[model samples]
Target: MSRLNRSRSFLWLAGTVGVTLLGSLIPLTTNNRFYYYDDTQAGAFGIWFEIGTKLSAGEWPLFSDTAWGAGNYAAEGQWGIWNPLVLLIGWLASTSPNIVVFSTVLKITCLCVLAAGTFLLAGSYKARPEWAAIAGVAVTLTGFTVYIDAASWVTGLMVFSLLPLAWFGLRRMAFAGGNPILALVAAYVLITIGYVHGTLMLAVLFLGLFAEAWLTARSRNVMFRLLLAGMVCGFIALAVYLPGVLTAPVTARTGGIANSGFLTPDLTGLATVWVPGSLPQITGWWGGFAPVPLLYVAWFLPVLAIVDYGRMWAGGKELAAIGVFGLLSLGLTLAPSDLGPLRFPIRLMPYVSLALLLGAAVLLSRYRVAVLSRGRLAVTAAIVISGLYLAWSQYPSIRMAAAFGLLSVAGIGGLYFLLFSPRAAPRLKSPAATAAGVILVSLVVAAGQHAAFKASPLPDYRMPDTPQAYSRQLPGAEGGTFVVGDPTKLGSQIWNETLASNAWYLNSAQVQNLYSPIMFAKYAEDLCITSHGWTCSSAGRKLFETDPATGKVLADLLSLDTVQILRDPAATSDDIFRDGPPAGWHESSRSADAVVWMRDRPLLNTGQVVWASDGTRLSLVSENSQEVVLRVDGLDGGSGKAVLSRLAWPGYSAQGASLAAPLRGYLVELDIPANSVGKSITLRFEPPAWPAVVGSIIIAIVVSLGWSLGELVLLRRRRPDKAWADRAMAEPVKAVSPQ
Candidate 1:
């Protein structure tokens, strides 16, 4: 590497980091609050925090009784429990749990990781310092990243951050024989899917790579090696992937959910990332002009890449087209047919952001704008603008079409310098000038946008710490059904103070719960709605209005025993004594945050063996969350049902009797014979045993490690084996460390 390159690298780091800090100065500097972005406040951050804490305490995560009867942890796609990082957080949370601190740190880590990944990937192409830095900074600045950070989509953040590195690895393997970094990053991503825009986002990344191999690698051997690299990546993370796929269908995620469509490209949003601070990523459309600066970096960068394509292609550049595929996806999103039912078009933003930045890197590598004729720049700009306009026209409504059309015209206007300017230098001054212009425009646009439409700030309130921060204690609540407050206040408390609330919003909620099939569904129900109006599931909510005769019966049927009436400041006007507490319950005690209530007739052991013929309900001797024991007079010669008070999921059985899958969404009912009544019968929710999963995980780890170790040994031996794609005398591929 040249001394110039090294210097450029350092400069890129400083400039990009400095600008990022400027963009996020408000949240970082504000001591009164940290970024929460509401959507993730309860669903993502608080829930994950609680999972970590519980994991640290040695609690079984797979089957949770906190919210509904059986919340499957491993099958919850977003949990990514198999990922080492998530597990580490869980472990850390157990010792010192602070949601704000953990969330803030994680968010920062993701941002830095993304910057590093972008830099490394861009630099790998031997791009000049200016180009590489621009690539890193530009991707980090876009609306894709802004919304992701605002919503606190930590999984998406982690995935996007690591994406460039993964692509870098893939690039090396496909173009430069093979690399270890590819395997490691692939494993990390496969283990954790949420960061790269959830499931569909991950699919796009793979598709983008597939396209790279299809277009760039002419050699079938190279393609096969790429395929092998993918296999290796999957194998390394198979422990998590295998179980996740298997249980997803039976649980909440059945068929992939249809969440795609309706994200038309905003031409002016092309430069949204250039805005200083939080301006670029601010929420709500400011009529598409909140951050408008009359000039944008988007106009300069794409045109730069378009004109520099001759040189980039000469450099054996396959990634250039691969990156642009991100935009192609946006066009597909405009189609009502759906991109095979992807999550959303905006979900493709991370890829789009990466691709656009890569294109910029190509243009900035040399910054010899003088090489391009005005005719060429103008033609290229016209073509690019045409594509965007076509996509905008596909929008379902005229309102959208007009909005996007306006942006296209505005974007075209911003390209004046690129197409017609004669002042551009042909050397170092060109790149330096371009970089300065991008930074200045970004800052100006961001500041302007903030001045126009500031995103709602993170709440000034702290994470719940005092007793008012916790749910009221119920002796019968643990390992049983319980409700904290009325339907209105049910899920509110889950994300407010606690990391993991007793809720069923976790993935594997049975797609009926989330209205999906193949894709992972995070939570279930709408008793508690998000600020965005997405209804979430919470079995912990009090009945709408306790049905006098049916409330207690239904509660007993679902094992609902305790209720905690939260003292809401807003609810002070409502009669807590009447509206809050359910019937057939007495006040236990009061806490800073809640007034405790216990059912006069507790349903702690609701599982009972009933003689069907006689219609006599027998008493349950003992029961836990997963198992219930009932003694029936089997010699009495009456067939019966072992009624367990819990929601029915697959894998439940009654020992020494037949188990009938519950219909009509009722409690699990098991058939019992009068002959066996004298004997003690046990009903247990026996999902797939942990030993098999543990064993498979162990085998997967062993295989992956053994392969990695072999690769390391091969690296030391320096063999140029053609078995994997490299030809004899070709330079052995450089080994990449596990990221």
Candidate 2:
């Protein structure tokens, strides 16, 4: 291959490997805990579990009381149905008794799909495979993104990753007219597949799509058809996920609902989590002492893209897409909503970055070297300054700063190619040669990053298995209703919102926790107060749970008090309750982390047991596979463990219990067996051994070294210079060259 052919081929190989590396790192090394931090996980996973159970029994999706029973805060609540795609995965996994393997495999699939989409997206832009691969890796390591994945925020990060690729695919179909309809159909279908987080991505996509259509008015028919196909595909995707979307409101209300006060665009700015304090200082600064930094210096290309596209609005497609994306970032960064939407949207930054980067690349591709020199320097300088500001404000580590420095230099090198050596060597003479080069680069990045990740994994962070594995018993008051709470709190790992407190209350089965909307409202208000450290007194606590309807201050009226709701009524219970000795409670045999009150409340006879379902026969192939509900006859007010050990049956263990008062009963959710009897089942839950920051560093080194080494080999064996250039642009006019 000629020199240019060799360069392109080498870059492609590095990119492929890098892409695979990125894919592996995102799923394999992620924290393997379940159901964390946001309502997204709780909603997605909870629904998945429920759907899986249903599918095993060959039943249609239906909202389950069991899932929503813990929360009394919503007007409507249920896990009736979920996105078909998620449900399908869950169903397939349910076929196996070993959930660990099932979940592991499923996650890997999601990551792989995302990786493929990312590759397609990068390819569509005609980006050097290496750069695209590196970008993918960077996107995966983004702090908020990693956190979301680790916390089981399935839709959060996964859906975000698909959007850009889908967009690229759509662009190719529309502009290039090569099975564009099929691509449009596929992209829309996926978007609507009930990936809850995709909603945000959808918003971004729509904005870009509209901009593209309006800007390219002369080609409006083509754009409109593409849009039409997209909408149709979107509908198809929705149908696939109709169950989940239809029931999401109920789940959100009862599960992870958070009401942001600033609905107006003007006020929405205040709802962002972009305060200087919220930015991750450590990882952002030092990049965990890794060679490459998360904030690459090449990111300046985005700035260049913005400026170059500023006045060049032939139609506004490119400018509009960039503009809308920038506004989105700005809005999200400014708002400080409880949902963390703004701050978390950083997960979507890669798309924005890609837009900027590609725009820069394409623009520079068409420019003369002499003209770009001055602009490139200015652009590079601005990037350095902004990067410094981000680093300083975010409080990143020195290692992180250095990583950015190196990455910045690399970006400058890329720019150097654009300005100084536009035609350093001839293009490839043959397509096969070019393709071979791309493959080589991809392998190198993939192999290198994988090695690095294995060498330095994320630190082991063990999450307590409360509702999932422990505490089968929970009390339900007779004539009293119980409420399941929002389990989304555990995602942040911040003390205030730990789900433990809520789980404990449920498992305790003490006085029936009323479904109090007022409580939710209070929780919201108290959040602000506690954040300010302004509400800590007993009075403050009482005020925090007050009911507007009854003019009743229920905080003191209720017998129960979580550390989160007392003393500093505004403080998250996490502050004082972060992993401590159990206070005023005793352990029980039937539950993991079960605690019984030392001083029991007066009883009006123990609460009566109302309902029980020990997921025993909720599987296929079992002769007695029948869903059954048990009614615990009578017991009121007493708050102690009540075991139905006598009720033990096949396919279940006799380790169920419920708190005494408010009729608490244990549920024995069963895992459907793959066969009548299968091999010894294993459940693995190993977390990474390195911190994310540290892991990121290792990834950087592997990517850089691997890319460098592979480049060296390709350079040495480059084909004749004249022969390569001919192949680089030798594609038939009908063939849609990848981005």
Candidate 3:
């Protein structure tokens, strides 16, 4: 290819990737909170927010050695295990809270990395501008992009957005027999730091890489080295991964009770990952935004890319795409979330899908001739299969099915003749024919999938509109205590102190027995004897009543120190405050939710003041505001009752009752008290942990200096003879490293 052509191709790639990234960022940035059941995505955002909060407080977000099932969503004082890279990014952005700006910057950075990587990968296939752009769009618009709920997951999504770039490098390394070891290390490390689910994805990538390398390497040592590099990265990734995995068994057990057959399907439900309509409730118009058509069509792209797959394989790229897609697909279908567990495959699928599509694009570009005809046929078949599956899944919504079914059929018919049997001389193998085929296939697939992709509606629910909203409204009272009516109670009174609102907390009459640990521990013997009613003890009542009482019981409950609550917009004065405090004294705070007066305030009547020294008579010494002295007759003999007036808080030596000092060293003594000798007391000191703080700052400085030094070395070492054009083309064609 000419230099002009290459430059144009690069420009086209830049434009396409830029546009796709911008589009993806739009929805992510706009939605302050997004609606989705994918907790992994939500967890990513939560991790970032927590890290941001921690960094703002001048602390590193360290891994806490603890796990609590119930308070996972409760932001403050929740479980604290975070991916380091994610913590680093959020910490970097802690200086500002304008999430939009932070997210935009990160998203752009991810895109630049992606584009550079793609350019390198595509250069291997000598892909044209148009073909490369198609690949870019396909990746940008895929279902994975939806994971970016801008408010919480900007960093995770940004990290995820770099997968294609990494894969591109992987491909180059394999083809050129270059030192891919470093690239492998960097890629795995970044993924590990980027998200918790990265382990699963990394697993798939490793498996794929191993398979690809073994099949292509000329020597046993090369294969061993590749596997060794992967093993090293795996060990490093495990540093963060082991903790997340440890918490999973507990998380699954706690979440298992919400397992509705419809909501949490068994083997049948697992199939829905591939088939669109199996879960119609999650269908586009219902709640799912991943259009049935789009997912279906995407699956077919790899099949169409088979022609290019042949060419790439012949050229030594190794046929890894098929193996990758197949492995991920199998895992998704078999991985259990509730049965035994929602295993690693659940996390692996999203990234695996990206590799699948990228491989397809590479193949499509290589066999441009076959892509026009055979590619269309394969895509058409895929659309048909997807449409059928979607319609089957939504069997009740037959009218909806009919509409999509007809369109899918007609699409296949139109594309079939264009490839297998053309109207005039069948301009097969011609550039124009092939180009036209590519255009038609791309349009049809995109349009078909777009039709289905538009299904996930913006959830109308907001804070207070749903149960999840309750956590958001909790606020801290003056003393850092907040009362909230638990939303789980059925027919229970909802006394939302914040906005003073009421809803049936949980309909208790409908739910007779509360299945809580407090109930089980306290009343288990009695309930077994009488076989009875809702016999809730004081602890059980605390466990059960939020606003209303929900029927089900929680095995474990983690209490919050502070909470903010939102009042229902429709609420009036009559809603929440009707019922007086239930068996407890009520004291209201200036703040709405600050009401506190439990009948049994445990610490009410129990404290004593004692003298630190036994003294007979005492004299006082007045010093600066930071010091004081007490004089006693017993100072010489050490045995007399010297009364010291206004003594300082116990720890310091009280000059008299009115004075004290915090320093431990000796001071000037006052005489006159005998009984004041040997009475012990307590004192308070407020010293900063300076050594630890200074050490952290020093480490930051060292890292910054090292990065600068490394950059200088890399710049000096860059290949001198390589031209802009040669570097641009060659960078993407050979295996590269972070150094």
Top candidate, metric lDDT: 1
The deviation in Å at residue 540 for candidate 2 is 20
Worst 10 residues of 2 by lDDT: 268-277
- Cα lDDT computed for each candidate against the true fold: 0.48, 0.37, 0.38
Q: Write the per-residue lDDT of candidate 1 for residues 263-325, one digit (tens) a residue.
A: 433444443322222122222233332232211224334355334445446654456445646
Candidate 2 lDDT score at position 104? 47
lDDT of 3 by residue, 141-210 (tens): 4443443222223434555555555555555444443344435534644544535454445556667767
Residue-level lDDT tens digits of model 2 in 1-739: 4677556655554554445444444434433332243333224433455456567778755322222223221111122132346567656634444434454455545555555455445444454344444444434433334433533445545566566566665565455543343354345445544443455556666676677556654486567656655555544444333333332332222344343432212221111111111123222222422222222212333334223343345422544554676567445533333352222333444444445444443333222133444555676566555555554445455654454445444544544453345474444313333334333332333333333333222222232333343234333322112222222222323222223222232233332322211122233233222211223333323323544432333322232322222222234655322223243322221212222222123222211111222322211111111123232232232222222211111112211222222111122222323231222212111112213323433443354345335535665565223232223222122221111
Evaluate model 3: give its lDDT: 0.38
Per-candidate TM-scores read 0.72, 0.52, 0.57
How far off is residue 509 in model 2, in Å? 12
Candidate whose TM-score is highest: 1
The Cα error of candidate 1 at residue 417, in Å, is: 8.4
Ranking by TM-score: 1, 3, 2
How does model 1 score by TM-score?
A: 0.72
Q: How many angstroms is residue 157 displaced in model 2 relative to the true structure, after the best TM-score fit?
A: 1.9
